[model samples]
Target: MLCVVYKSPNKEGAYLYLERRDDFRQVPTALLDTFGKPQLITVLNLAKREHLAQIDIHKLQAALKTQGFYLQLPPPPENLLAQHKASLQNDKG
Candidate 1:
């Protein structure tokens, strides 16, 4: 399926994917408020076989089918060393 994506003005790397271009009616008003204004990004074909940098294509398709929109939040920043130490402590505890 072809999906249209919009970038949020308020958040970096945050994107909203919709089933169609120029349609935000299915998006909740409260979410739109928090998302700020959306800037058009691109339209692409989404499929389980496709690869996306931050989002899973199958999950995006499921979300779009059920919710009419799919939200792609930025990937969480990693702290590998800190996480390793925390894991060691947990193992000891």
Candidate 2:
């Protein structure tokens, strides 16, 4: 299926995918407010690809079919303090 991709300037690396271009009927108003103005990124054909850079192709397609839209948030920031605590525990062990 062909899907439209949009990126929000408010949050870096965050993307919103829609089943059709400029279609946001399925997307919630609160989400749209937080997502900010969506800048068109690209239109992708899922059937023509095996994988996506950061998303699972199967899950994306499923979401598009069921929910009509998919939100792609950036990975959480690394927690240095949590890592340090884990390392200290390992050292004690």
Candidate 3:
């Protein structure tokens, strides 16, 4: 089992992606503190595979909170200017 952490492109929040033996799961980033950079902690519960299988947003939040983390949803990705231009040209044509 492996847990990966990533910061959002907008720098607003982060995300955690978990890889297990047979599946993958995503959890919202956690805001731990007010000072310094917010650290996102991802714990791979090797023994709780069964529980994780039925994990919901609230349960995920609670699990993170137990480790002194807070849930934070990251901002959506911004559209690139070039991509936008191309999309507009395609629509016009």
| RMSD, every candidate, angstroms | 3.1, 0.9, 11.8
> Could you arrange the candidates by lDDT from highest to lowest?
2, 1, 3
Q: Write the per-residue lDDT of candidate 2 for residues 18-77, one digit (tens) a residue.
A: 988999999999999999999999999888999999999999999999999999999999
TM-score of each: 0.79, 0.94, 0.26
lDDT of 3 by residue, 1-93 (tens): 333343344345544433332122233223223222424445565444544443364555455445423234555677799789999999999
Top-TM-score structure, candidate number: 2
What TM-score does candidate 2 get on C-alpha atoms?
A: 0.94
Deviation in angstroms for 39 in model 1?
0.3
Higher-ranked by TM-score: 2 or 3: 2
List the candidate 3 regions with Cα displacement exceeding 4 Å: 1-62, 65-68, 71-73, 80-83
> Which clashing pairs does model 3 show?
none
Taken over the whole model, the C-alpha lDDT of each candidate is: 0.90, 0.96, 0.44
Cα lDDT tens digits, model 1, 1-93, are 899999999989889999999899999999999999999998887753477887777888889999999988888889999999999999999
Cα-based lDDT at residue 60, candidate 2 = 95
Cα distance off (Å), candidate 1, residue 52: 1.4
Worst 10 residues of 1 by lDDT: 45-54
Candidate 1 achieves a global lDDT of 0.90
